[model samples]
Target: MVRVLLVDDEELVRVALTAILDSAAGIEAVACDGPEAVGLARSTAPDVVLLDVNMPGADGFSVLRELRALPEPPAVAMLTLLGSDEYLHAALRFGACGYLLKDTEPHLLIDCVRILAGGGVVYVPPQSRAVMGTHVNVPLPAPAAPELRGRVTGREYEVLALLAAGLSNTEMAERLGVGMTTVKTHIGALKKKLGAPSRVALAAVAHREGLLDTASADRP
Candidate 1:
């Protein structure tokens, strides 16, 4: 079972989210206000944390930073009513594993938690990409070998391409016609070769190095 910690200043919001999470199979959720978030996170050692962006005192960013500083930090997913690029980018910079709109469907919310718990990243509704402008169409330059600082195999290159397209591990597995473990292995290899700290950073490096452009041209 995946243990989840819910952090929100609003009592009603915590109650609603906790109920939703508890009812789902294979999940157990506990709630705390922003002030208590870090302490409870250390004590409970949850697998994932669903954090509200707007809180009365410390706010989400501060809480997120503190949680990430723990010896064994839980994966965090920012839950917010706002879709502002500022908050999204801040959360990513602070080491959040996911960003989700509060109005997301309950089932999808559960799925996002499960994904994060399984060592995957999630940023949903596609519009969330606006924060990084990751999907904006731009004129492509002539194809060249992606300047990967470290050697990466051809199969690793394929995985990186799908990853830059924002596909999750499960999606990558289906696309590659491989097992989930194989997809994860490729992602791990890519992370080491690219020296990326997170999936978001890995995608950013791919864009910066023109890997995305190369991948797009190669797609038939």
Candidate 2:
């Protein structure tokens, strides 16, 4: 069974999400307001946590950081009424395995829990992807000009392109027909070469330096 802790400030939202998750097979859900989330997670030890982005004292990002500090932290997915590039970037930076809108369909929401519980990342529903792409495609300041060319290997460049496209390591492995460890190695190498702090930052750098455009042109 997949145990899920649903955290939200609103009682109604928490109740509704619990019901939806409980209705699904092989899933059990519990609820708490944002303030109580960290405690409940430690006690309940759920496999996944659905955390609200906006809360009274401890917002989702704050709670996410706390939860991750736990000895054996549950996989966390940020739940929000609003979707934006800023939220996506913040969530990813803070170790969120998923970012989902609260208004997501009941079935899809259930599926997202299953995916995260099964060691997959979920940043979908099209709207989130569009927002992520918008932010990544922005004309941010590039790193030095000469530092851009021929820094990453061909495979690493392909991996970088998919990262900019918002594909997770698991998804990238399938797409590239490579193992997850191989994908991770490429990502780590790219991070070092691009001097990016995180995958999100790497994607931003790739866009700013026109690396994704160049990679596209080089592809058959």
Candidate 3:
């Protein structure tokens, strides 16, 4: 069975989501407030976590970071009402396995939980991409790459696509069937070639460059 931890501030929201998740087969979901998320997660050691983006006390991102630091971190998906690129970008930076809207279909939500548990990823909705494409105002830090003008290799494009998919360094390495050192090299090369400073910036560039589309991320 896939164990899921659902964290949200609103009681109604938690109850609703828990009902949907519990209705699915081979999945057991438990609900909790934002403040108790980390503690519950540690005790339960769930396989997947559905966390709300905005909550009192500690936001999803902070909780997400703490979860990632655990001895065995669960796959976390940021459940949010907002479809803003800012939230999506932040979720990726914090190593979230998925970014889903509050209005997502019940079936899809259940499937996403299973997917995350199976080592797959889910991202923002298609409509969110249109909004993301127009969001060039997101701050891109100074580049650490040596060159700004260069060619992006085929493998680097693959890396960019996976990076945009919000996979962490370790996740990307596993997905690509490569070593961590190789993955790091590709990422550094992408940053230099694209003149990007952070993973968020790399993801933005991937979207802008058409490597990361709404449904799937593909290499050019």
Candidate 4:
């Protein structure tokens, strides 16, 4: 059986996650808030831990550090609403094998949990690939993607599409014949407008939103 731990301050979230994971075949799920997490994980020895980043007393990063230090540590992942680079970096630095957005669909969540349990890593917004670069083990996925109609500026959308296509910031600047600063500005705006956390996520969002499909989109 695959043992999974769901950690979140929100009662509803914990319950919901537990139910979802429990419903999956060959998986057993247990949940607790941040303060109770390390203890629960130690006692239960879950195969995978889905930790929440922002919590009252003991935050996710600290708990994650403790979990990784266990004599027989389980695969840990940060599951949070905020998708910022700072949190993503901290999770990786602290040894989280996965960094997932809370808004993730149910099936994808299960797949990520399974992957992490079986000694694998999952990076949410493929853009993290460029930043982290083979630091962890994983496979690339081709998502179905979404539609983006006037949600971002034309330049920003172009940057995002190029980002999805696996172009680095330096590469993108050269491709667009713009200064690095200009490219950075467009990326920042894209993240703010689209609520993406990191450049990797920006790229992931680019593919998720299918920005390339509408390269001719209207700009403001």
Candidate 5:
């Protein structure tokens, strides 16, 4: 079961989230008001934390940073009513595993929690390529090799596409007729090749590089 610590100032919000998490099998939701979040998180040591962005005293970002500083930090997903990119980027920079809007579909939100708990990075909706009104170009680190683009083999590329499509490792393995271990190995290699910080980062970079554009690359 995935243990989740829920932190929100509003009683109604907490109740709602608790209901959603409780209904989802394999998730244990532990609710707490804003001030008690850190204490509960430390004591409970949940697998993930669903934190509200706006709260009394220390805000969600503060909580997120604190959690990341822990010895065995739980993955944090910031729950907010705001969709501002600034807030979204700040959450990601401060070590938030994901940013989810409050109005998100319950099942999708639950799925996001699962994905984040499984070590995937989740960002706010509408994957934008612009950073501060400028096109953000993700440059490959050091002496960019021509072959790095093709380093991920055709089959591996297929795996990456599936990954971007949000398929789990087991699902990818089944879809590609490969073993789970192979899928894991490919994902690790893909991360290294892309110099991405997470699976979400990898997908963003891939999309930015036109890897997902079928018109740009021949998909097998």
Candidate 6:
């Protein structure tokens, strides 16, 4: 079984995550309420740590740093309410294996745990290409060949904008009043045109092209 240490302040989140992880075929979830996480993880020697970003004390980043400093650091995946590049980059830089959003689909969340166990870096939904720094150097994605631009439609642009803004398919569907399938179709087409490997890369390409302005404007 893949032993997991779940660290979050909220009782409900911890319970829900434990339920999800434990119910899965080959995983066990050990819950920790707050700053007690590092000690528990050290004692248990879990395979992975599903850490929350905003804790009462010694927030996730600090916990992660301490974990990495350990002689045998377990894989860590952050569970965060905020999806900003600053948090994502910090987690990754501090040796986190993956970053996941709080409102993730149950199945997806389980899959992410498995992926992290298998030594993969799982990017969260609505992948943002922005990095942490004052220097903003957005590069064009190589996949969007010259011919593809001639075929991009208006809706495709909208999808790219939303992707750049880190909105998930479900979120985008609600905002745009469309079905998830419809949103996915646009995303696939955008990927084909832009040659982006994933939505996050696509968002980076969109930002390079200045398509995120519309979506950013929509935000308060």
TM-score order of candidates, top first: 1, 5, 2, 3, 4, 6
lDDT of each: 0.80, 0.82, 0.77, 0.74, 0.75, 0.73
Q: Compared with the true structure, what per-residue lDDT tens digits does model 4 show for residues 133-176?
A: 43222222323334244566677767777766656566778889
Local accuracy of candidate 6 as per-residue lDDT tens digits, 131-184: 422212435445443455456676777777765655656667887899988997
- Whole-model lDDT for model 5 versus the true structure? 0.75
The 10-residue segment with the lowest total lDDT in model 5: 127-136
lDDT of 5 at 207: 68
What residue runs in model 4 are displaced by over 4 Å at the alpha carbon? Answer: 134-220
Error of 5 at 52 (Å): 1.8
Worst 10 residues of 2 by lDDT: 134-143
- How many pairs of residues in model 1 come into backbone collision? 0
In candidate 5, which residue ranges exceed 4 Å CA deviation?
33-47, 65-75, 92-97, 105-108, 115-147, 150-155, 179-182, 209-220
Any idea what lDDT model 1 has?
A: 0.80
In candidate 5, the residue pairs with backbone N, CA or C atoms under 3 Å apart (3 or more residues apart, or in different chains) clash, namely none
Clashing pairs in model 4, backbone N/Cα/C closer than 3 A: 83-197, 127-200, 128-200
Candidate 3's TM-score: 0.63
Model 2 agreement with the true structure over 29-136: per-residue lDDT tens digits:
999998899999999999999999988988789999899889877889999887777788778777687898998999999988887875566886466667566556
Best-to-worst ranking by lDDT: 2, 1, 3, 5, 4, 6
Error of 4 at 13 (Å): 0.4
